[model samples]
Target: MNTRALSSIFTAELRLLVRNTAVAVSALLMPLVIGGMFVVSGLQQAPAAGWGFYVALMLLTVFGMSGCIAAAGTLTYRRDELYLKRLRCSEASDATILAGVLAPVVVVTVVQCLLMVVVTAVAAESLPANPVLLVAVIVFGTVCSVGLGMATTGFASSGEQAQTVATPVFFVLIGTAIWAATDLAEGLSTVQMLSPGGAVVQLTQLAYTGAPLSETASGALPALGGLVAWAVLGAGAAKRYFRWEPRH
Candidate 1:
């Protein structure tokens, strides 16, 4: 990492994030909204084992909405304002500039995650039994979300267009994960494992419930592999197709 340039770029991005109302709201407010929804919905007992199931589903739910919004909105704002173009003309390298642009999204994701855990622990009495596993899912999940957002920016023309461009993926990611984990979609059991948030939520739920998913390398390895693949795919797309300039 180019420390000095990265720091300056990060600082500049942070100021922009502070000024961006949607980014700020999604990072801070959306959690409260979802937390409220979860509490209202209530956590019913399932036959499933492990704390990972619940924690993973919950965190993924948070990520699907808030993380996507932050990523798309931030990218659109920067691209629209020619910020990415301007940065390219500066002393910052492409990699360093990209990192700085994503810093706020990463920070927001991490902080919101901590806040979610604390709130869930206090309010719902649902604690992450294995903090290590939870951290892994979170760190990986954030990376995937940021990368996905960057990839999605290829289609976004303006900040106002972010919500429309982001909604379909957001809905699919959250909806599929929730439906797969919950009893609602008992039919798709086989392929649910292939869903975007599938492995992450499965991994998280396992982390939370303290089940024996880890004992079976047969199952555990596949889920880990899937999440890793998604992360790589998302990052790869961003690297190949992410546009720093406005589309014609």
Candidate 2:
């Protein structure tokens, strides 16, 4: 990989993200606002499992907005503007280009997630039982969201269209996460474990609840496998259909 090229692209993308007021607000500020609300709300006083629910919600919100939607919109804008085409002509490989473009989004999402964790912990007056597991979930979940975003870019013809196209995905993710967190669909536990959003929620709850990996392997393993499966599928879809320039 072209580290220098990758660095350059990442820096450029970061600058652009800052300049775009709408995207910046949606990806960065929204999480803080939502987390702040949680801190002051009655949810903070709920039992320990409720705190886990809050953390899971924060993760879902950030992943959906920053990692998935923002990535899709940014990539679509770049492609529409021929920015991606210019990058394709550079010495950087396709993988490096994609990484560079998506790196800022991924970094931002992870940071927001970590920040939410701290906020939730302080609000609930307790740190995560399994810090390592929580971090793992954050990292893997961010990657999965990015992969989904990349795939979304394949169908979005423009930046504006990207948002509309990504809405259903974002909602579905949030819905499944809620389902997993609430256990409303008890019989569908296996189905939930297989879904990307549900898997993330399941893992986040387990991490916060202090469940040991070995003890929770039956559920955790499926959740992890499900996340991996979604990530791989997203990557495959992006590889096949992603465009470097405008359709016209």
Candidate 3:
């Protein structure tokens, strides 16, 4: 990969993201709204379990809406506009192009997570017990979300329809997050823990409560495995089905 070329593409992608108000609102503003609600409702000051759940919910909000839906829309729009095809004809390799497009969202999501942590710490006096796990989960969650977005883009015929194509996926991810955050029967909780979103939730819980490594690992293994599976599945589907040209 050409460092200069990648940087240039990332800058252009960032500019494009900034120009699209809908993208900005979906990717950033909406999550902040939800986070604000948690603050306003004083959930941040709740018991350890409740605080953990709030963080998990916020993570899902930002990751699903931005990394998945917003990213799908941007990529589909670029495809419809022949931007992706044009990039292919340039010196940028496929990897560079994809990375460039993904960089901004990943950066934004990370920043959002950090800011959320800070807010919780200051306002609610809640801080993650395992900061490293929290960071790891955020990074992996972003990767999976972006991969899922690209995969979802394969179903969109145009930018206008991208969100529609993404709706089911959005719901599943968000729904799973909600389920994971709620108390459930033991069997059901185990199933939820193995879901893509559940994996992220588990990590968030560990970070929030500072569970011992043995317990955290026992739970995290399944969640991490699920996350890896989703990443592979999404990336493979995108590579196989992503449209490089507008459909007739």
TM-score list, all predictions: 0.87, 0.91, 0.90
Off by over 4 Å in 2: 42-45, 48-50, 184-188
TM-score of candidate 2 versus the correct structure, residues matched by position: 0.91
Q: Model 3: how far is 25 from its true place, Å?
A: 1.3
The prediction achieving the highest lDDT against the true structure is: 2
**lDDT of each structure?**
0.70, 0.78, 0.76
Instruction: Output the TM-score of candidate 1.
Output: 0.87
lDDT over C-alpha atoms for residue 240 of model 3: 81
Q: What is the lDDT of residue 121 in candidate 1?
A: 73
Residue 14 lDDT in model 1?
87
| Residues 1-248, model 1: lDDT tens digits | 68898888889888888787777776667766776566444455432453344455557756765676678888888888898898889888888988888887788788777777776677667776656667877787777777877778788788868756766766777777776677422432435655666776666665665555456345445566777777788788778768878875
Measured on C-alpha atoms, candidate 1 has an lDDT of 0.70
lDDT of 2: 0.78
Q: Using lDDT, rank the candidates from best to worst.
A: 2, 3, 1
Prediction-by-prediction clash tally: 13, 0, 0
Worst 10 residues of 1 by lDDT: 183-192
